[model samples]
Target: MHAGPRPSILFVTDLAYPARGRRYCDEDIFLTSRLREEFDVALCHPRDAAALLDGFDAVVVRNSGPVLHYQEAYDAFCARARERKVPVYNPLTGRGDMAGKQYLVDLSAAKYPVIATVDRAGDLGLLPGAAEYVIKPKLGADSVGLRFVTPDALAAEVGAEPDGSVLVQPRIDFRYEVSFFFIDRDFQYALYAPHPEQRWVLEPYEPTTADLAFARRFVEWNDLAHGIQRVDACRTADGDLLLVELEDLNPYLSLDRVTDEVREAFVARMKTSVRALLH
Candidate 1:
């Protein structure tokens, strides 16, 4: 073992969270085990993160489940980290899903290659002509409260909710979904579910230069200096990629699906990133 002061990290996770199609605990367990080689690590539930972060050099949020489940606690932790100036992995500056789904509406307004999104009834005409629309809470995660409604029923469904509390989008019939994983702005790996019905049955994806360029656009837009990010998108029937979500907050790495060599490389990159944050 190397003799020196290993920085301490309070790794936040929900080891018991019942994430569908994924094992949150096993990924965190594997990550923490590898991280232990370079830092003094402690595991804590998201609820305990705010209270337990004082003594650690940094707080790393991983697989903590959706913040919607514990919004108050997660907000408190974020506020505390900011108030006390404690470094947080993902850096608390992400404008992606970490903030909310508002980015979708904003991106759509700017004509970015994202699924057509609108939160207001008047803007409903902006979306492409589709048989059904997908509506979900602006603060939702893990597909919570997601519903599909026909165009005729769209206004009632959207108007029933508190103004600006939900987002509506035309449900595109995409060919497949793909995700690009990045570490500190550098593309690391990509995975895709060939079958649209089975979103989690991922296979290693060899991204074309054009594909990488498409994914990188958002990464460049986010402008995050460090932290892990997952660019989730769907390939439309017309062979265009549109942003589905930008998961900057504790995106499940799906390490189990990748090769051992790729996993090792990811861990090494993470260790270096953490060290850079400390310095």
Candidate 2:
């Protein structure tokens, strides 16, 4: 147990958020219940976080849902957090999905094992030839504004984004999707979906050394000194892992799917991370 006065944490979440295939409220409720044992925990919606932050020792963002739904408010919260120098879990400096989808393009350019991404028409050639290509907003989440276009329609689709606000990638033919969860750079657990079309029917995954190495590459590249991160990837037909995304900001913890022992360990690690952040 912590010896000093318990540090107060403003746990930010949207309890009413109706996420498909997951209960945001249940996850946040369970997490906060455990966290309350070690800190002064209070729940607030993301829109209210900036207003409520001044009174807390730190802010813990969990299952707040996609910031796109409340972009203006979320941006304000970020600005306020920066102005106050408030320590936000998953720190705002994260270069992964927290910032935007641009990291996909950056990683692909660096020859990382990520799906090829391009925003401009000229660079579209870099992507492997596929019958259909994916087009998604750079700021999109939860599959928002995602569509598949044929090669004939690609240029028009690319040209339609006058502001260059979208990214394009080849729709990868993959065997399955998997996610690796981490707390403060330590691998906690892994989960995977056996069916490519059914993403949320997750089962506990025991990652091989090669799988761990692949996932760790992005975690290490993200370089977040503290906080939780989820490395999402897909296994190709050729048996290689390709990064799908690195979710650092409010990544949903599918806590319901893991074993009780794994959940306990994750909660313990999170408490340790929060304590480390406070001191």
Candidate 3:
């Protein structure tokens, strides 16, 4: 085990970021306040991480927002972290949204019940027949540049760029959306927005054994043994859960929505995971 005080952590975040329907600053403030008790913690934006990371035992990236907005800074941070062998929570090797939207195409091709996706014009034909399609950048976050287009318009709009320039997916007609939260691969409480229009209005959701099993599959696929993750899915008209996104990077915990008991449980679980990472 590495010897030290309970592992000094650099918690990366953007407190002032304006996130629609959610207060990004409020969530980060609450988390840091609790984490301060057991950790030597400092907060910084994603841009400064590369410069400050070498001084900390580990870097906890929380609520950092979309890297697409600050690509150069994010790239430098990842490169420096890898070069220095700095331990980054949620690690730098995540294969889901952390990497890009290419996983959508991969997962869809593998027939994982995900929304059908395509990255190229030639491949648009592969998408299932739908009335409308959603197009967004492959590296997008917070729904930036998302648009709905009829299939006929896609041929002119699809661009050939391998640098994660874009992604095309059918707009799923789902009843509602749910998110399953996890800490270091361990399942935590789940919350769902019963209404389709108000995505941020969440309520406590007790997952059945089958629901837990489905959520666990994605968590296992992610393979992160540290940090937190949120598996987002939509319930289709046919009563099936289809993968919407796997948020492995600074997934907003929505802690204020859960009960006191659930929130305490989550905090306790996070403490255990962070302590384990210290070794």
Candidate 4:
């Protein structure tokens, strides 16, 4: 508990983090601004979190960039938070991209609706054949270390890399990409990129019953009782939604794309989730 009254919240973010089409700073600024209305919120970079977390009652990790950029420091922060039994907003139970892309491999193996993913070259047979394959580091985010290879080059590319070092998936021809934003297990809103090439130019999406079901499968599969999770999926050419990634760590909400009413509702949901976390 804070010395004063309101539960202090250490909102973790990297304001200067550069992204291709997203403004990392703007989103955090909007969230922290709204969050401050209820709780005592202070902004801190991810690297500084471990040292400063002791001052706050709880820590909320948002848009701190890929852990790949600060692996050692992030590990230390997580270690210290757990060691001190700090109430982290995400509850440290995140098993999606928060942990790594390994969940995709696991989900795919279990016949989940995720894009078929495999680590070893020999396991290529398990994946449905496609003209091209997407290979990326198991521990990657923000399109970092992602690659595309022809079927012939796929074997060499994957084989040259260490097994489990990278993930391989078929580059499906999809109509569009959509992201479902959730506060805890509650659905907030969805946004979709109508153009595949222009992935960041997002617009409001009205999810169908099946679309919501497709997205919910991963959210439920993640097994987290709290935390913001973004289920990013691609609408395949066959009119089916396949999970691209489950972003539970610090999913960029793209609040700027939604209506004010929806955005306000989302912030309210987040505040409620935080209040619940504190109490």
Model 3, TM vs. native:
0.95
Q: Who wins the TM-score comparison?
A: 4
In candidate 4 the C-alpha lDDT for residue 51 amounts to 95
Candidate 1 per-residue C-alpha lDDT over 1-279 given as tens digits, one digit per residue, 9 for 90 to 100: 224588899999999999889898999999999999999999999999999888888999999999989999999999999998888999999989999999999999999899999998778889899989999999999999999999899988888874888999998999999999998899999999999999999999999999999899999888888899999999999999999999999999999999999999999999999998877
Q: Cα RMSD (Å) between model 3 and the true structure?
A: 1.9
Which residue segments of model 1 deviate by more than 4 Å?
1-4
- The local lDDT score (0 to 100) that residue 196 gets in candidate 2 is 86
Q: Write the per-residue lDDT of candidate 3 for residues 184-210, one digit (tens) a residue.
A: 888898999999999999999999898
**TM-score for each of the candidates:** 0.97, 0.98, 0.95, 0.98
Q: Candidate 2's error at 120, in angstroms?
A: 0.5
Candidate 4, after superposition: displacement of residue 238 in Å? 0.7
When 1 and 4 are scored with lDDT, the better candidate is 1
lDDT of 2 by residue, 4-76 (tens): 5988999999999988887889999999999999898989999999899988889999999999999999999
What are the RMSD figures for all models against the true structure?
A: 2.0, 1.9, 1.9, 0.9
| Candidate 1: pairs in clash | none
